[model samples]
Structure formats: structure tokens, C-alpha cells
Target: MTIALEHPVLHSTAIALPARFQASYTTRLVAVGVDKRPSDFWLETAGTPQAGDVVIARVTAINNHKRVETPESRKAILFEGVLVMLAYGHRYAADQFLAHVPEDLGPCHLVAAGGIAGTVTALHDRVDEPTEIEPLGLLTNARGTVNVRDFAAFDNPLKVEAPNKRAQVIAVLGTSMNSGKSTTLACLVNGLAAAGQKVAAGKITGTGAGNDRMIYHDAGAHSVIDFTDFGYPTTFKLNFAEIRALSVNMINVLADSGADTVIVEIADGIYQGETSRLLRDQVFQEAVDHVVFSAVDALGAKAGVQELQAAGLHVAAASGVMTASPLATAEAAAVLEVPVVPTFDLTNPEIVTAVLTDHA
Candidate 1:
């Protein structure tokens, strides 16, 4: 094999590689190209690669502060391993890929734990710079350039069906990331399970991360899915049609999974482009039977609730970081005219029963 002996093959669960490519590789054959863009690659490495196909690249840079999220929600712990990143173009975030995949296989950055690869053009002040990495070579052999699309769930084609009325959907929205959307959904899943309802939960938007899915599983959800399952590393750049199709397909998948209730979470805030668009879609709105908005403070909670109400979604309850503070919860509840359930009380099966029963 004529591959460069630069980086070792360090498999990261972030990309689902074929069994053949799982072995230790000192050197391997690689057909390099310079025209493919990052957005051209899939999240998994399981398919035949044509001239424009994207392959899994072994990122050589490892920064302690920048860790990759594994499929099971475990961190790859950068210092000890090489990061496998997906080279793709991002629309909403600060980083993006060069117009074309570099034939030289030079340096790049692990822009997202979900294995998004690109050059860091900009970043929020709060986050450390993206962990830099090198594109050692395309993870490939005699077959072709392996692409993330090979292992994607949508490989089978996601045909969206009408809303499944048999299963009630509890859509959880948040004012922003880290606003306790995952926590609230986990608690609600636990509570619903305790109430003897088989629950299926999924994170519909945002970047691909197993942490939220793991939370749902730990909360006793019978099944959990996310946008990653639909072949997207992140939902930031997806068009409204694509987002709408993925959202509807995800809900239907959960409903078909035999879940008595489906708990769906749309990442980011109501004001986010994708979130706002989905909220405004009449069909998407109909797919959701109940809405629980999460926020950081009383004001955010009130605003989030108003956003939902204006979109024609009935805000069932307000929860999240605000609920941690009794005063904030009370204030939000008063203004929003909705019960503010604290995180600790979320597991109380009574709360789940009350909400579901009331909605029923």
C-alpha cells in the first residue's frame, strides 16, 4: 500500500467504519482528490466512494479541552486518542470547510464532536478554539473511498407519513442550548415510564451527540433516536424541507417503535432559524400533541412560552434551569399561565399522569 505513514488508525465511534477498515494500518492505498467539500461527506464510513465522495480522515491533533463524543455518549478524551472527524461545510456555526477537499491532506479542525471537519473561521468567545487536525488519508482500500453516508439510517430513504395519532408526542423545546432541554426530557421520560407508559424519545435537531440520546435511554425510554440517524452531522445548515422531512420521519419512527408516547426535543431556541421554521410548519405543529418549553430564567421562560403560544402550540408546562430556582419558576408560571415543574419533581409519576391525562 502507498498510503502515507503519518497518523495511526485510531477508530473513534463518532464514525461507523466498515469491519474491513477496523484493523491497524501502518500504510494503505488512498486515491486523493481536491474537489470534494466537507458537506459532501457523510457521518459514517461504510459506502463506496466516487471521485467526490468524502472519507473518514484520522485527525492528528489532540487537545485536552476538545474531546469527541462517542456513539454511547462517552467522551473520546483527546489526549489519549486521535479524533476521527467528518469533513463538512457548516452554515450556521463559525467554522466551515475549504471550497474543496485539499489533495495535499493538510491541517483542519475538529469543529464538532459529531465528527464535523472544517477550518475554524470564527467562534463564540466562550468556546476554546477548535481542536486542529490533519487529514491523514481517506479510510479506504480496494473497494473505494468510504463515506459516512454508507452507515446512515436514511440510506433506506426516510418516507414521512402523516402524524401517527395512536401515539401522543410530547415535544420539548428550549430557549437555547444547555437550557435544560435534555434534562427536562430525561426527567419526563422517567416519569412517563413510571406511569406505565412505554416512551420513545429522540433529539430531532442540532448536532449529533449521543449524550441526549443516552439520557433518554437512562430515563427508561424504550427507544431513542436523533438527527444522526437521519444522515446529518448537524441540522444547522439543512433546508426547511430537509428539516421538516427529518422531523416528521423521526416522529413516525418513534411512533412505529411501539411507543405509547413519543418525547421529541428540538434543539436550540424557538428563535433559531431551524426551530422557528419547524414551529411554524402546520404539519410539523400537528405532529406534536404537547409542548414543554425549557428556559434559563423567568424572563426566558415567559418569552419561550409566548413564542410557542404564538406559533399555535399549547405550552403544557415550563421547565428547565428556571425551575431550579423556586422564585424564577413561580414568576415564569405566573406570567406564562402554565405550571412550572421543577427538575426534581419531574420523576414524580403523578406529574406525568397529570400532564398526559389533562392533554388526553
Candidate 2:
């Protein structure tokens, strides 16, 4: 049992207690359910509550009719945690317990699951959302190229292998997290697919909810996969081999699915952590194809190139913040001995060829 918090992982809090009624489960029950909320049977377990037990719990309160400046009508859920309404996803009516969630990057308002207690359970399926890693069925047809429920993530509307053509694999590497790695991949996929290339995309890092894949699909990628695609509640405590093997397996799977170009999105910076970082090891360095360096500015971009190339790898293209100005892109590329691609929307399709063509 592991929980993802504070960017780094803390195994200490990931308790795997066999919750028994009035035993180990007592503390959790007292901490979870309270107030006028309906007492649920399916949400609560009689004996020790396990990880996947659906508990109809309320959040501790904030103030009533709380005012949020963001205008994304939200209320602090008692007990569960916080629920945030992302700009995307199923629009909930007021009846939805976690209704007032926002459309931005904030904490969840209600962190617990709601439903009749003792609804149903199998050997595996259970509760979710930042806690248990139970794979549940999607109530609605997933709207995007990827489907993430609990810890299980998979490509939505699976792609069939056509014409006996092998899937083209393209792995995107960034200097760090939130550095436009996915944004650049989205652009690349658009360019490649528009040029008649069948694109399959996925992310390798164990962070970020769905920001990376949203554009990857909107930009024209066919199928997308990420760590969430696998049954991982979060990427915490995983070893380097786990990350590498997961990346390799996802690419291989996408390749088997017959993608002309399987775009792999690497989460976090190349140098972020031992478990998620790929650039720190020599073996991992030799396994990758092209490295798409994403940084904040010209100087940061230049620094990333030197650090990566010094590890004996080629810096394929530079992207991210400097995409607005070709001059900033050109300066970083010159310093790193690679071409610069700064467009966020796949404006130039030829850029993919410059980085991937064997003619270098």
C-alpha cells in the first residue's frame, strides 16, 4: 500500500491493515463517517475495512457557503478529502456528492467514494482516488484516447493492427516535470499523423493526472498509454528498472498495436528521481531513440543539452517555453548540436524527420 503526495512518495502512510469491525477498522470508521450524512452499508465494512472498501464518509467541515474566488463553484467535502472538478470530464449535477469541484489544478474537495454500502465486491475491485489501486469499470464511454479508472489505465477505443505494418515508436524525453513534454509530443503526433503516419502515444513518468495525454489525442494520436494504463495507484517507490521496463513494455505494446509512430511521454525531468528518472543511468541512456529536451528558457535549455549529451546521448530537439520565438529556440539548438522545435500545435511537420530520420 502506497500513497502519492508531496511529489515524492511516502510508504509509511500506505497502511495495508486488515480492517476488522471494531478492531483496526475502528479508528478509520470514527475518522471517516460522521454528521447527518446517510450511513452506508456498502461504504462501510463490518470487520476490518480493507483498502478497496467503499466508505460513505463526509469531510470535516470548512465554513458553510464558503466563497471561492475562482468561480468554479466548489464546497469542501467533509472527511473524504477534497474534490476538484477538472475543466474536462463528466459534468456533475448538484446531486453528485463531489459536485462543486473546480476545473483547475487544486486539491480534491471530497476524497471518499459515495454509493450504497455493500453494493458489490470481487476478489480485486474496490475503492479508489489517490488511495487503493482498484480497477473499476467506466460508467460512460471514455471521451479521450486513454481510459484511467483507479490504478488501471488503458487506451480507449482500442486500435486494430492494419495492413501488417509495424507500429512506429517515438519516445519524448524532457529535462523535468511540467516542462511541456506532453505538449511537444501532442504537436509531434499532429505533424506525423497529418503526414499520414499512424500514431500511438503513451507517457512513462508516474506523475501528472491527464494534462499530457489531453493534447496528445486532440493533436491526432490514435492510441495513448501511460503508467496509469498499467494498474499503478501512483509511481511512488518504484525502482529505475520498473520505470524502464514499464516504458519499454508500453512502447512494445503500442508497437504491436501497429502504430506508425508510438509517442512515449516521459514524466518529470530526466533528472528528477531514481525511480522515475531515465537520464541518470548509462543503460537507460542507450535504450532510447531521440531525446526531446524541454526547459523553461534558452539558458535552461542549453544546460539540459550539455547535461544529457555529456551522458553520451543525442539531444534531438528543443521545445517548451521558448516555442514563441524561433530565435530563442535556435540559440538553444546551436548550443546543444540539435534542431529546435518550439511550435505547440504541430505547425511544421518536417521537424519530426530532422530528429528521427536515419540520415543524420
Q: Which candidate is the best by lDDT?
A: 1
lDDT of 2 by residue, 252-332 (tens): 677776677777876656565542356655545544556677776788888777777777766667788676677777777
| Model 1: lDDT of residue 215 | 82
Model 1 scores a C-alpha lDDT of 0.66
In candidate 2, what residue range of length 10 has the lowest lDDT sum? 132-141
Lowest lDDT block of 10, candidate 1: 22-31
lDDT of each: 0.66, 0.46
Off by over 4 Å in 2: 1-57, 61-168, 275-277, 280-283, 358-360
TM-score of each: 0.78, 0.57
Q: Best TM-score goes to which candidate?
A: 1
